[model samples]
Target chain A: MKKFLSALGGVILLASSSYAVNKENTGCGLGYMIFKEQEGLVYELLAVTTNGTFGNQTFGITFGTLECKKPEKIANRKLEIFVAENMDELAQDIARGNGIYLETLADLMNIPEEERPQFFSKLQKNFDKIFSSENVTSADIIDAIVSL
Target chain B: MVLLHFKDGKSLIDDPSFFLSPEGKKNPYKELQATIRAINRNPYLRCKFPARAFFIEKFLKINLPKVKCPELDKFLEEIKGEKISLIFADYYINSPASMFGHTFLRIYDREKNVYSFIVNYAAQVNDTNALIYAFKGLFGFYKGYYYISPYYQKIKEYVGIEGRDLWEYELKVDREMLLLLKLHLWELKDKYSHYYFFHKNCSSEILYLLGILKPNNSPHVRTPWVIPIDTIRAVLDKNLVRKINYYPSLLTQLRYLSKHLKDDDVEKVINWAFDKSELPKNGSAFLYEFAAQYVKFLYYSKDIDRRKYIKKYLYALKLRSKGGKINYSIKPEGYPHVSHRSQRFSITYGFNKVTQYMDVSYRPAYHDLLDPPQGYKKNGEIVFSEISLRFLPKLHRFTIQDWKILRIISLEPMYSFYRPISWKVDFGFHEFLNDRGEKRKFLSITSGFGFSIGEKITSFSLGEIKVMHNFDGEMPIAVGLRIGLLKQGKIFSFISSISSGKYLKEFNEKYFFDYSLRFAFHINRSLSVRFKTNYQLVGNKASFEPSVSALIYF
Candidate 1:
C-alpha cells in the first residue's frame, strides 16, 4: 500500500512540479517568443529577466549571462523523442521487451514489466508499418497499446 | 582526538570537526556518538544508515544491530537495478543558481522501469526568484540537504524545460561501495551544510559523500572557487565515470525538427498547436510530433492557465497519437564537456604602424565573438577583466593598450520569424593615434544599437556613439557609423568595416575616417594566426599598416 501510494505521488509530483518553479530567462523562452513573433511573450520574458538579473555573484556562475537557455516548464508526460526518432531501435528493444532504450520508452508509456511483454509484442508485430510508413508515430503506437 | 575541521580542505568537513564543533571541549563527539548509539538502540536507525552502521561495526570490531522497515526495504530492493548514473544538467543561462550546471544521482530500477528515484543534493531555498536564490547561494546563507525525488521529475526539469542537454555518466561501483555511498547520504540526509556557491557546492558535496571512490586529497577546491566542470574533470582524472550517454533537450529536439520541416509545415505545426478547432493534417509522424512538442512548450512557458490550455494540450497529444513513430534524433554539434574552461590567456606578435610588437592578453573569464565558436553561440560574446599589454620594439617600452573592465554584445541577426536588435556596450581604455599621429591613451566608452542580418558571411552594420573621456582634444565625445561584413570560414575568417566620426565639441573640428580588413586562421583549437591591414584618413593625412600575429591560448 505504501509502494502504491509512493507511485501515485510520483505522478502528482511530475505534474505539479512542472508548473511550480518560475525561473527567468530560459534562453529559449525569449528566442521562442521572438521567433513566434509574440510581443506579449517578449514583455513577460523581459519582466522576468529584469526582476532576477542581479543575483549572480560568482565569476564562474556569471558566464551564463552571455547566452540564452531553455526555461523550466514542462508537462508531466515527456515526449519519447529518442524512441520516436529511432523506430527500428525501438522495435528491436520492444521485441526483446527489455533493454536500455526500451526502459525509458516503457517508463514514458507507463507500462509495467508484467504488461510490457504483451503490449510491446503487439508493437513488434507492427514494426514494418511503424518504421516504413512516415505516417505512423510513437503516439500511434501508444494509441494501439491503448486499444489493446 | 583533536577536533580540527579541515578548513584547509576548502570547507569540506573530514577531520574531527565533522563530529565536533567549536564547543568541542565539553560536547566533543556528542552528536556523533549519539547517532551511533541511537542506531544500536533503535532498529529503525539501522535501516536508515545501514552502510554507516556497517562502517561503525567494522571500525569498533563489533557487529552492529539491524532493524528493517518493509517500506525502506522495498525501496532498497527496487534500487538494486541495472545501473547507478550521475546525471549532469548543463547550465541554463536564465537560472542564476544553475549557471554553472547541476549534478544529481539516479538509481535505475529495471524491474520497476521508469520508476527510478533521483537522489539530489542542493541548497534548500524558500526564495522563488532565481536572483535572490543566487544571492543567498553566493553568501553561504542557505542550508544544503539531500533529498529523494522521482527521476522523471528531474528529466522534465532538465530535458523538457531548460533545453539543456543531459549527460548521464554511469558509475561502475560495486554493490558494497554503492550501498556505503547511499548509506552515507542517508546518514547526512537532513543535516545542514553551509552551502557556498564557490567551494561548498553540489559537486563537491557529492564527491565528498562518495568519498570511498574519490581520492583522499581534495582537488583544487583548496582554493576558494570550485567550478562544477572542474570537478567533473577531476572525477575523470580519477577515472570515476564508467559510461556516458547524451539526451537532447526538448528545445534542441524542436530546433532540429523545425530544421527538417518546410516553412509551411512549421507554420502549420505552430498554428495547429495553437488552434484547438483545427483538425489534424495528413498524419505524418514528424509533423504531428512537431505540433505536439510546440503545444507542450506553450503549455509550459505561456501565461495561459492549466485548465484553459489543457484542452489544446490534449488536442495536440491526440493529434500526435494519430501517427506512427518515425525514426530520428537531433545531433547538436557540441556538448558542454567539450567546451574550453572559462579562463583564457594568450600571447600574440604583430606590427603596428611600422613598429613590431608582442602583446600578451589575459581574459579572466568567458566567451567572446572572435573566440572559437565550437562550444559557444556564434554571434553572442561577453568578456570581463580582459587586459592586453603591448611591447613595441621601436619604442623599447611596454604599454597597456586596452583593459576592458566589462563588455557585452548580442549580434541578433534578423530572421523571418524574429527581428531582435543587435547591440554592444564596452567599457575600456585603448591607445589611439591622435590628429598629430601621437599615440595617446584614452578611456573609451562605446555603445551601439543596430540591425545586423546574415550568417557565415555576415553583413554587420552599426552606428556607434563613443565617449573618449581622457582624449587630448577639445571635444571628447565622438559619434560614428560603421557597416561591414564578417566572413567566418573553416580555413579563414575576416571582418571589414568602414567608419567615419566627428568630434561633437570645440576641439579642432577633427574628423577621422578609418577602414580595416582583418583575417585569421584556425591552426588548432588552442592556436590561431591573424593578419590585418588598416587604412586611416585623419583630415586627408592617411596611414596604413600590414601586420601579422600568432596567438596561443592556454
Candidate 2:
C-alpha cells in the first residue's frame, strides 16, 4: 500500500509540473512594447497570459510596435559596447547604411525605360528588408543611424 | 697793343702821348693804352681796366712806350676814380678782400688817399657754371650739415656770413632751380621704376648715406625684399611644408592662399610654412585665425556635412560655452548628457481621441548599472551608480530596404544589442535573496539597451550589474531573460544580466543574474497600470518568488 501511494504521488507531481508549465501560457497576446535602440524604434510582443494558461504558443511574441520607456537599459548597453570598442566604427556603420541605400536607389534608376516597374518591384523585394517584421536583422537596425 | 674802339666815343690813344712832360715817364702812358685795349675786348673786364693800369703804374712802375703813351697815369687815375665811385655808389661795398677775393688793386690819388678794387666771382670762377655750380656745391655741403650741424655752422660763421643769408640770397636762387629738378626726378622714379638709382647702381657711400635710416630702424628703407601674398604662396608651394616659424605680418599673406587655393593646397601651404627652421615665430594668432576662418568657410561651403563637427570644433576652440540645457521642448521630455553611461527612467503615454477605446500600456521597472567597469559593487552609501545613454525621440520600424542597407552598413547589431532600450537608469537599494535563501537588501545598479531588427524583433542588452556586499563576498555573474507570463490583458517582460567579480584575498565571490517583469496593461495611453516583480539570480538560481509592485502612468 505504501509503495502504491508513493507511485501515485510521484505521478501526480509529474502531472502537476507538466500542467504548471502548460498553464504558464508562453504565447504572446495582443499587446506590444516600443523602445528606442541605437538605430531607431523596435517592438516586441508581450505575453499577457498568466500561470493558468497553456503554453501552446511556441514562437515568441510577434509585436506590431515596440514603444517602451526604459532609458537605463539603453544607456547601459551603449556604455558596454562602446567601452570595449572604437566609437568611430559605429559612425562608419551609419554612413555605410546611408551609402548602400543611395546605391540601391541608383540601381533602380538604371532600369530601361519600359521595364522600370519590374525593376522597382525587384528593388523593393531586395532592399526593403529593413522595414518588414519577417526579414530584418539586428545589424540592419543598429546601423540605421542616419545622424548622431 | 692792338687798336680797339670803345662805346664811349673817346678815341682810345693809339699814338704815343706827348702830354704831362713835367714828370718823365710818370704818366704810364703805354700801359694805360694797353689796359684800354683789353677792356674794349671783354666788357665784364672793363671795370678792372683802370685798376689794372693803376697797379702797373704803382707797383711795377712800368711806363707805356712813347708810341702807346697818352698821359696814361693821369688818364688811368681819373678812370680808376670813376670806377671806384660807381662800385661804392650802392653802399661803400666794403667786403674784406680775404673774405671776398684777393683780386684788389690800389690807385694813388694824392688828394683822396683811397684804394679801388674790382671784385669778381674769383674763388667761384673756377666753376664753369659760376653761380649755379657754386650753389649746388654749397647745397651738397649742407646735406652734411644735418649730420654735423654745429661744425658746419661754425665753419659758416668763421667765414663771416650767416648760413641762412648765404643760402637765401647767394644760394637760394640756384637752389630753387635744383629743387625743381629733384621733384621731377622723384615723380619719374615713382611712376616708372624702382630703379631710379639703378643707373649708378648705388655707390657704397650712397648705401652708407641711406644707412642713416638704420638707427631709425625703418625696414621700408632697408630690406631688399618685401614679402607679399603671391611671394609667400610661391615659397610655400615650393618648399615649406611643416611648422615654420613666421612673423604675424608675413603669416597674414598665408590667408590669401588659403582663400584662393584648394583646400588641399591650403593645407599643403600651411604645412609647408610650418616646417622651415628660419620662419618667424609670431604666427600663433595668425595660424589660429587662419584655421578658424578656413574651417568656417568649409562649413558654409558644405565641404563638411555635419553641424555637430562644426560645433565640436568651435567648442574645442572655446568659442562656445556648453550648458546642460537640451532640446526637450518637443513631445518627449528628457535631458540627456554627453555621458558614457547613465541610468534613466521615464513613463509616457499618448492616446488618440479618434479611436473608440483607449489603448493603454505602462512600462514600469527599476534598473541600475555601472560603466567603465569600475566595480561590481554598488556601495550602499550611494544607493547605486551607473553610466547611461539614450537616443532622442524613440526607436521605430524600418523597411526591408532599410534593413539591407543597415546590414551592408553592418551596424544593426549595435542598435539591436540593448535590452529594455528606452530611457532609464536606476541606482538604489533593490530587493534580493542571499545565498542562504533569506530576504536581503543590497545596493544595485542596472542599465539596458534595445535595438530594432525589422518591424517586430529586437536584440536587447543589459548594461551594468553590481551588487553591494554587506558581508565578505563578491557579486556573481547573472544574465537571462524571462517573458512567459501574463495577467489581465497585460504582458510582463524581464531581463537580468550580472557579472561575477574575480575573487580577491578577503572576499568570497558569486555570480548573479537579475530579472524583472512588468505586468503592463494595453489600455489607452491616458491611463495604464504596470505591476512589476523583481528577482536576482545567484548562481544556478530559479525563478523569482512572489513579490510585486504597481506603477500608474498618466
Candidate 3:
C-alpha cells in the first residue's frame, strides 16, 4: 500500500510541474537560464555575422510551454520565463526600487496598479530572500516570492 | 504563375529541374501550364507547391485533389501563426555587415505570443576574414538561405547581446495572408539563392516575402542599393503596418538607467563592474542596479566569461532585490526612416591661390559628419565613391580634384563607465603637391585610431598613418597625429582639423602640416550650404584654398 501511494504521489507531482520548468537545465540557475546552451562554432560564427544564418532546423517545437491551457499554469510559466530572461535587468530595477522591467513583472503577476508600489518595495526589501544564493534558479525566486 | 520568382522576364530559380516544361524556366505561361498539368497528374506536386496550388485553385475555380503532407501540416500546426510583423533591428556600428541595419519577419503565434517564430534570410558565410566576406557578399558568391528560428533567440541575439534596438512593425495581415505566407515559406524550405549584399540582401528578401500578400501593391526599392530602412519606408508607404513597438537594447537601457547617477556613483558602479571594489553597503538601489547593468554590458562585450559574469551579476541582483522599486520609462528616439536620403550631390564655386574654379561633387552613399544628424549615428561618417571634379575657365581645364573610394569615421565620445575607441580610415586618389611644388595625384590610404571626448561640440586626437603612391614616382609613407573638433547642430554644423606628419621619402625625411575648417548651414533635410578652407605647408612652402558649396541629398 505504501509503495502504491508513493507512486501515486510521484505522478501527482509530475502532473503539477509547469511546462516552463520541464526543460533539461531548469534548475541550473541564472547562468543557464539566460545564456543558451553553447551551440559551439556554428552559433558563434552566425552571431558574428550579425545577419543570422540557417543553423537551427527545428524552430517552432520549443514553444509548447507558452501554450499551456490552464490559466494559472500559463501565468506561472510566463512569470518564470520573464524572470529568467530579464533577470539581469530585473535585478537592477528591483535593487533601485523601480524600473520598466519591474513594472512589467508586476503586470505579469497581476499585481494591481495601486498595490504595485508596495509590491515593488516588498520585493526590494526581500531581495536577498528572493535571490537567496548565487545558484538560485528562476523557480527558486518564484517560490520565494510566493512564500512572501 | 504570379508566385514564380521572375526577374527581368526570366525566372530567378537556378534549377531548371523545378519546371516541367522544356522552356518553362524562361516562359512563365509555359511554366503555369506545366504546373497545372503536373498538379493534376500528381498529388505530391500539389503538396510541393501548396501556395501555387491555392492560387491556381482559387483562380480556376476547381478543387485539386488533397494529399497528405505531414511535415508541412506539422509545421503549420506548431507555429499557429495568426499575425505577421516586420522587425527591423537598428544598426550596430561595430559590425560592417549590420551598419546599414537588418530586417526580418516575425510570425506571431496565436496561442503563444512570446514564443513566436522568426523568418530570416541571410548569406551562408563561413569566412571570418572581413575582406573576404565583403568580396563574397558583394559579388553573390555566397548562397543565401531562409531560416526559421524562435523569436526569443533573435531577441537575445540582437537586443541582449548585440546591443541593437528593435522596432517591431506589426503588419496588417489577415487569415488568408497568414496562410499564404506560411505556404510560401513551406515552399522555400531548403531552397537557396545567390546573395547580393547591396541588392538581394536580407531586407530585399523580406520585401519579396511581403510581396506575396499584396501582389498589386507591393513595396519596391527604387534606390540602387536595398537598404533595410528603405524597405521599412516602403512598407510604411503601402500602409501595411498597423502598430509599432520599440524594444531598446541592453546598452540603451543601461544608459537610460544611469542618466540620474552622479559622477561619484558612476565611478563606483564602474569600479564594481571591473571588480576593483566591492558593492557599497549603503548604496542606493539605483547604484546597485547601475552596477548590475554595467556588469551585464561587460559580459555582452565579452570582457567577462560566463562563470565570473553569473557570480557578479547574481550578487548584484541579490543586493538589488532588497531595494524599493522606482518607476522609470525609456522614450523612443527618432525613427530611422525620418533621416535624410543617403546619396548626396553638391556644387561649389570657389577661388584658390592660382585660379578660380567651379567644382561638382557626388557621393554615392551614406552620411557625412557635417550632414544633418537627425536619424544617423552622432559624430559618425561613412562615404563611398565620393568624387569631385573641378573646372577652371581661365586655364580651360577640367581636373579630377579627388576621388574617395571609401571613408569611414566613428567618433564615439568617451564616458565615465563606458569608453569606446574613435577610429577612421580613407582610401582613394588624392590631389597633393609634390616636392617640386607641382600639383600631382597620388593613390592614398590613410588610417587613424585614437580617442574622442565631449558631446554636441566634441574634440578628438588620433595617431595617423598615411601611405601614398606616385609621390615623385615613389611610394612615400608618413606617420603622425591628427586633432579635430566637430559641432553637430540642427541648423548649423562646424568641423576643424589639423594634421602634422613626418614623411619618409627615399633617403629624405620632411615635415608636412595641413589645416582645414568647414561650416555647413542646413536649410532643410535635403538642402544645405557649406563653406570650407584648407591650408597646407610643406618644407616652408604654403598653399591656401577655400570653397563654398550647395548640397542636396536624395
Provide the lDDT at B169 for model 1. Answer: 71
Q: Which digits, one per residue and each the tens of the lDDT, describe model 3 over residues B158-274? A: 887777888888888768867887887777766678899998899988888888887778888788678888888889999998888788787787778787778888887777777
Scored by DockQ, the top model is 3
Which candidate order results from sorting by TM-score in descending order? 3, 1, 2
Compute the lDDT of residue B81 as modeled in candidate 3: 67
Docking class of 3: incorrect
**Scored by Cα lDDT, where does model 2 land?**
0.24
TM-scores for every predicted model: 0.66, 0.19, 0.84
For model 3, fnat equals: 0.29
Q: What shift in Å separates residue B286 of candidate 1 from its native position after superposition?
A: 0.9
* Span of 10 residues, lowest total lDDT, candidate 1 chain B: B1-10
Q: Which residue runs does candidate 3 get wrong by more than 4 Å? A: A1-29, A32-131, A136-148, B15-24, B109-114, B395-397, B471-473, B506-508
| Worst 10-residue lDDT window, candidate 2 chain A | A37-46
* Chain B only, TM-score of each candidate: 0.75, 0.22, 0.95
lDDT of 1 at B473: 44
Model 3 CA lDDT for position B117: 66
lDDT of 2 at A118: 47
- Residue B349 of model 1: what lDDT? 70
lDDT of candidates 1 onward, in order: 0.57, 0.24, 0.73
